[model samples]
Target: MDPWVSLDPPMPAGARARAGEPGGARELVTGALADGTKRGDVGGHLELAAALGAVVPRPASGSTATLWESLATLGAHDLQLARAVEPHLDALAILDEAGVAVAAGPGATWGVFAAEGPGVRLVARPDGERWLLEGTKPWCSLASHLSHALVTAWVDDRTRGLFALDLRDPAVRTGEHAERWVPRGLPDVVSTPIEVEGAAVTPVGAPGWYLERDGFAWGGIGVAAVWYGGAVGLARRLAQPVGRELDQVAHLHLGAVDQHLTASRAVLAEAAAVVDSGGVTGSAAAALATRVRSVVVASAEGVLAACEHALGPGPQVGDASYAAALADLRLYLRQHHAERDLAALGRQAEHEGPWWTTRSAT
Candidate 1:
């Protein structure tokens, strides 16, 4: 995979050999989270990455090199789970549990698994102290290999629940969703739909992890990173061979995206810092974080649009590569989270700290 060629780089080598050291997509995510945990409370993974690199920085370790290659894991679903592990998580980077019970439980081990849509349903009930789950989930990004899945289920049909189910058990069936498997965006991204009937599960923590709590909104990071990567690829593809328009737009496009990326970094850093220091659970800093993401996504869209104009009609239209990336990214743009997440940012804006608050003095 050539980032210049396909806006995606080739997958790294030797998963079998690297089995113990930061191997697989989940490990990569775990490594990244571990890195962020060392730094602060950031949730937007890329921003956390940037903050790690640009702000606090990660400990120099060989594992990080693998972590860098693991970035490609997000793109893995496009190539099936095995090929998708590296530098990106098959582009399924966004993972948010509606509640703590869902986000932080045992099945949270499968937090690396990105569901097809954010509309993942979880069904949890009390069977003594342990909870049991039964429901269908589509778009389990790494479901092929993911042994656990963190989900938000319904409680008593009135409220919802979050559960972490161990997919390792034969009782918990794991396979691609035969009924519906194709997604308009991220094709080859086998977000396998899942159906768990009476699957043995466990409760992660309490109810706080599963709800639309503070940290829930922090999920924009991975999605933003993948989309950003796609935008970079598109813009790179459209980069003018020697033209006035595409070439000029490329510089402007990068500049605009840089501002958003920078601000987003700052916001995420603050959010992470707040969480790290125990200043807030999640929402204390989500407003600015979401705002930064909004800008980043908007600028990324501009980059895509400029790519279209730069490459001209015939090339982009005729080329299979452009069509593929465009289709996938376009679908992401339409998802419930993209727009709704921004709406979330807007809704929370009123309650943010002084940094994001309206200035009456001005």
Candidate 2:
């Protein structure tokens, strides 16, 4: 199946240049925001994500091949630019977390609410046969723009559940979001805290539905793919022709960067095939995500360092698009979780077994 079907079409001239600007990601879909309007070609971004079945990830509707394809495209373009897009993808992950899928309107957008830090404690209260969610949910990306969200909340002392929340509800408060989301990289991404009092919500699945499924790790690898793409984008700068003035040191740096990227790409390709074949959930998928994310993160960091050292400040200070990509990639790769993720990887390796195993000739 052709994974790029939706995204392969020509985009508006200079749209990408604009996308590198602050809060400019909205232009990816440009006129699609207007009600009842269909923007030429641009309208296909989401539809292609849906059609590729990567971000949505279900046997009945999506595929890993599609997901990787989309991630590579988005990552290479601008990692930060995808911030405006990933929340919608994450919304799908949340519903899939609950083993539920609901048809949404063409322009509908969704956000994920799983930030476990100081914020609102969402509690589910019984409202006759229905459920009401009360309290605040933090790290709600695109809260101001989304029509709905799949929120995680405490159903009781022992259970957590996934809820489909309509953002348009009068009980939902998104007014204070803008003041809270000031970040250097994805500053335009409005990941804010939202308070909902007595807001009605539909439970997508039974309790503990969001994290127990295979999609959890699958979604993680998708994020890694974005990072990988960003790394590729940075590496592309080094791929250009350097005049004879280029030194052996610069040539050596470029070669090392290429090796890292090539290795990481092979790992990513293998992991995608593993996920597509199934059975890569629970600890197994987690291991895969950590390994892939680590490799990609390392590659991106190494490439960034090598490029900065060899090319110096030319691209970063003078080239607007290149500078944005470099800055965005530096920030986006922080999703790696550093030591915490490395600990998880170590544990997985210990549990899996000895790395070197010799077998008798068949």
**Top model by TM-score, which number?**
2
Expressed as tens digits, the lDDT of each residue in 175-274 for candidate 1 is 6554476665555444566677787665544654444544344344434444444555555555434344535655675565445434433443343344
RMSD of 2: 8.2
Q: Give the TM-score of candidate 2.
A: 0.79
lDDT by residue (1-362, candidate 2, tens digit) is 11121212235875552122122222223322332222222234444334333323432132554455456656666565455556567667666656666666666767677776664488888789999999988777667766788888898888888888988889999847477555666555557778898998888877886777667777777777777777777776776734435579988989989888776777776776787677566777778778888887888789889888888887677777777777778888887798898887888786573363764455
lDDT of 2: 0.67
The reply for model 1, stretches above 4 Å from the true place, is: 1-122, 142-145, 176-179, 212-214, 240-282, 336-339, 351-362
Backbone clash pairs in model 2 (N, Cα, C under 3 Å; residues 3+ apart or in different chains), count = 2
